[model samples]
Target: MPPTSPALRIEVRGVDATEPAVAPALRFLLRLEADAPIRALTLTTQIRIDATGRGYDEQARERLAELFGPPAAWGRNLSSLLWTQTVTHVPAFTGATTAPVTVPCTYDFDVAAAKYLHGLPDGEVPLRFLFTGTLFYAEEGRLQAAHLPWDTESAFRMPVEVWKELMDRHFPRTAWIRLERDTFDRLYAHRVRHTLLGWDDAVRSLLETSGG
Candidate 1:
């Protein structure tokens, strides 16, 4: 069901919802996937629906509770501080369904790959976060009714500092990146993105690289 009122749109702001707010680092990944600014997401329809007294907020709270529990797997305590090694900004070009969205993470990944290209210790390279999410626009504001997929994953044994530089240069709009405490060391490969890569040639590259 689309939003009953254009103003009564639904939005899921990616955040650190676990234990004292999800880790800022993980929250950063979610923020990158959001359609609007992190803060605006929660109050998307607040002023518009406030006058109607529809209890939209309450309903949203419940819906979010259910969605976040499964959709978002990263708990709190994840954060990042940018430290650059060698960074470069390049245009992100990708698309799916006739929508052209930039694949900034690809640039970040390629940039981060420099270290490995140069041959650096696995641990010396910083962790890489390529969290990707898509927001569907169906009719009006019924975000809940739309089907948007979320994919979060990382590359490990990487030099941490180098990854930050890559993100800073290619994907600054994204927020902090930090090491997961448990260190699930093996390359925790997930189809994560800083933004939704349209299902096009650009996305094809990812699939090809992943052997999809």
Candidate 2:
């Protein structure tokens, strides 16, 4: 009789702010299980926000209007949002092992993921993880490699506070936004022309002038 191929399973246990809190990032704890000993693993994960999996508050719905249109149309417009893709190398393990999947975060409002996250109020952020990779193992004293199943996936509801805390640690009270070079040049000229002490003053002056 022939030996059966090994199978793998993955689960997300929890999430936390990265250690040292030096930058904006989050770490997802993953439990990896296999029927047979795994010599090595090259894992690729695609993290997505299941936008429709959870409910949103009125404020959140209003804020997210730019992304999903009016709340009335959200029934059809809301869909999964691709957050990020990360790759990690898992060390040798016999039956089960734990790994950390670190995801870097940005505060730039120009980024859709950031905007979506910021729009949310207090609640868990529905997340989906899609995984595909290659695994290496010993078969009869010979090195063997196998491709992971295409259906490997997991779901997790990450707290919005975790992301907010991470950003606060790195950026304090400041937020970031990107602008076109031409626009920046014009803003800079306006700032200089008005002898504004800071960018905030220049922007506020413009907003007031425009009746914003």
Candidate 3:
């Protein structure tokens, strides 16, 4: 007879920003439920943004057009976008257990996930987590291992306010943008020539000069 594998279920409980970290990070609490005793487990999670899971206002549609194209073509353009992947270790547990999954967040506007997150006005961000890995358990008085099934997945609706507040706490009225070295040199020179107190002033002056 084939060995029976343990069926594990995972759920996202909540999300919060980790304090005193060198980089921006969000921690996800995952609750794992299992009927059999799980000696140990390794979980790989693929996080995706379900773009079509929620409604979008006109303003949001306009902002996201660059990513998903025009609202008129949303049926074809909108789809789940891969956000990030993470691996977590689960210790021995019986019945149920919870683990903290720390996911790093990037503020760079060049990232599609970042742009999509920032573009949202207000509402919950629909997220889907695809889980797969290895599971260890005991059966017939002997230890055994089995592949964590691919069909295991979880969905969570994260409040936009949480993301916004996390960014505000870390950046506080500041936005990050990457520019080519030449462009940066030119901007630096302009700031020096104008004796600008900050980069903001230099950019503002250049915009005004160009009638932007």
User: Which candidate, 1 or 2, has the higher lDDT?
Assistant: 2
Q: Residue 116: error of model 3 in Å?
A: 0.5
Query: Where does candidate 2 clash, by residue pair?
Result: none
Stretches of candidate 1 off by over 4 Å are: 1-134, 138-147, 150-157, 160-212
Better of 1 and 3 by TM-score: 3
RMSD of each: 22.9, 1.4, 1.3
Per-model TM against the reference: 0.17, 0.95, 0.95
Total clashing pairs in model 2: 0
lDDT of 3 by residue, 90-145 (tens): 99999999998888888898999999999999999999999999999999989999
User: Tens digits of per-residue lDDT for model 1 on 98-149?
Assistant: 1111212233223323222222222242333332233333333333322222
Model 3 alpha-carbon drift over 4 Å, by segment = none
Clashes of each: 19, 0, 0
